[model samples]
Target: MNVLSLRNVTKTYQNHTAVNNISFDVPQGSIFGLLGPNGAGKTSLIRMITMITGVDQGEITLNGKRLNPDMILDIGYLPEERGLYKKMKVGEQLMYLAQLRGLTKQDAKRDIKEWLEKFEASTWWNKNIEELSKGMQQKIQFIATVIHKPKLLILDEPFTGLDPLNTNLIKEEIFKLNENGASIIFSTHRMEQVEEICKDIVLINNGELMLEGEMNAVKQKFKENKYSIEFDGMLPAHLKSDSFSVVEDTQKGLVIQVKPGHDSNEFLQSLIQEGIHINSFQEILPSLNDIFIKNVNNKI
Candidate 1:
């Protein structure tokens, strides 16, 4: 089931188009990536989805109904810009935001404490927002956003300002939320994170969808049929097979590009018969970053 969708969505500014007639669906209980470079209309699309701004054309639906005022509670948004009051005490600030989300005072306080403890940030509760480090503030904002337990979470550049350790902290929380039944729309330029967590993605470039599909299927579309084989002995000049061409050679192994319709088993057997003792054999897959750059260049 689609938790969120846009049909023929478009946004235009004074003599400029930001998002242009794009449409996509994000399924319930899955992580969806909204990706693009700077000035690529991704921000405009995201704003429209969250209703922070109105669309110039088209319609949006959430949970099979037209998006409306009441639906905002069902969605949580963590924007790139931090919005906490600098002088506000962390715990009090969180409690206020939670109440704004419609959570009762008692429930909000209980959940905020749990989140703080889970992130190992309990010590930050008494500190003012300005006194906390960037990573600490991010953790606080992240906790505040989800304290109400909304059905949908939209995170834009969610991992910004976080170190590797804190980044993973938020990542684990995102995974946990999905496991407990919240659909996430994760938007960022970090393609590796998308590859690691998102099962579905919609990529936009210059106001158009560069691509959108299940992450694995989309990755398959960009495969180059490359493989890395590490062995203990010298490799033969020919494997008696034209299916693969050795692209890189080292003292320990060879990296080859297998031709389309070629049999990898036959190639491996030839290596084996040549007395090459295998240490490791693995297919090489392109990362999303690699594919994203190539696709963007192709479109340009």
Candidate 2:
């Protein structure tokens, strides 16, 4: 089930097109990655989805209904730009935001306290936003965003100011939210994070949709049939067939590229026959960063 769908969505500003005719679906109860380099229209698309901006053409739907102001109540958005009122007390600010999201005063207080405690931020509840560090403010913002238990959560560069420890904490919370039926749209320039958490992704480049699919399927589609081999002895010349070539050779291992029509099993046997005592051999899969660069560079 898709929690959100964009159909031929296009957004333009004067002579420039921020988001072209791109369409994608965000699956329900899953961590979905919205990825691209800077100026790739990702922010424009997100703004439209959050109702911070409107589309010039095409349609966007949330849970089968047309997106509008009312739907914003069902969505929790944490933008890359921090928007906390600097002088406001953390606890009071969170309570206000939660109330605006339709939570009762009592309910909001309970939820805010629970989230603050979970983040180990209870001690800073009385501190003004400006007094806290950037990472601390980020944690408070995140707590406020989800305090109302929104069904759809959109996070853009959510881990920007967080250290490794805090980043992991938020990541665990994201997974927990998905488990509890919240559909998340996680936007980031960090491909490794997407690989670790997202089941599906939509990548954009220059306002165009470059790719969209399950993470594993996209990786498989772009696979090059390369393998990394580590061995004690040097590879024999006879084992190097016309269909196989060493893309890289180092003290650690050899990165071998297997051409089309080459048999992996036959390649392995040849190496064994040559008396090469293989320590390890494993297929090399392209990372999301690799694919992102390849696609974007190719398009450019």
Candidate 3:
């Protein structure tokens, strides 16, 4: 089921188009990646979804209904740029944001305490936001965003300023939220996280959609029929065949690109004929980072 859908969405400035005739669907209870390079209209689209900016053309639907101001309560957003009252105490600031999201005082306090403890952040409650380090302040802001438990969570560069330990802590919570029925839209330059956490993705560049599909499907669609081989014997300097080409030599193995209409068995036979004792051979699948670079460059 789709929790959010955008149809022919476009956003424009006086003389510039920030988002141009784009469309995509985000499945409910799934972690979806919204990815692109800088100035790729990702931020513009996010602003429109969160109601910070209005769409110039087309429609956005949330939960099968046209989007409106009241629907803001159904979304929890953590922008790339952090915003919190520097002088406000951590607990006070969180409670205020929760209230704005329509949570009652008692429920807000319960959820805040639970989240603070879950993050190992209970001691930070009384400290003013200005007194905390950037990473510490990030924890407070994260707690505030989800305290009301909205159905849709949009996080942009959420791991900035976080150490690996804290990053893992937050990552675990993100999974837990999705498992419990929240849909997520994650935006980041960190391709590894997208590969690790997202079930599907939408890629954009230069105000246009570049790609969209399930994560595994996207990688499979771009597979190059390459293989990596580890052998016991030394590799010949100029190994070549009409059926295959040595793409590169690694520290422990050779990467081969199988020619069209040539199967792995034929490639392996060629290697064995040359006295290369193969220890291991595996098909190489393209990484998400590699695909991202390849597609963006091709579009350019």
lDDT value, residue 88 of candidate 3? 96
**What lDDT score is found at residue 141 in candidate 1?**
87
Q: How accurate is candidate 2 locally (lDDT)?
A: 0.91
lDDT of 1 by residue, 1-300 (tens): 999988999999999999989999999898999998888998788788778889899999999998888888899889887678999999999999999999899998889999999988888788999998888888888998788898999999999888999888899999999999999999999898899889999889999988899998888888898889888756665663678888888676788898888867878887777777888999888889988899888888
lDDT digits (tens) for residues 82-123 of candidate 2: 689988999889999999999999998988989989998888
Worst 10 residues of 1 by lDDT: 233-242
> Which pairs of residues clash in candidate 3, taking residues 3 or more apart in a chain or in different chains?
none
**Ranking, lDDT, top scorer first:** 3, 2, 1
Model 2: CA > 4 A from native: 273-275
- TM-score, every prediction: 0.91, 0.95, 0.93
- Number of backbone collisions per candidate: 0, 0, 0
lDDT of 3 by residue, 45-80 (tens): 999999999999999999999999999999999999
In angstroms, how far off is 222's CA in candidate 2? Answer: 1.7
Off by over 4 Å in 3: 234-239, 269-277
Off by over 4 Å in 1: 123-126, 238-241, 269-278
State, as a TM-score between 0 and 1, how close model 2 is to the true structure: 0.95
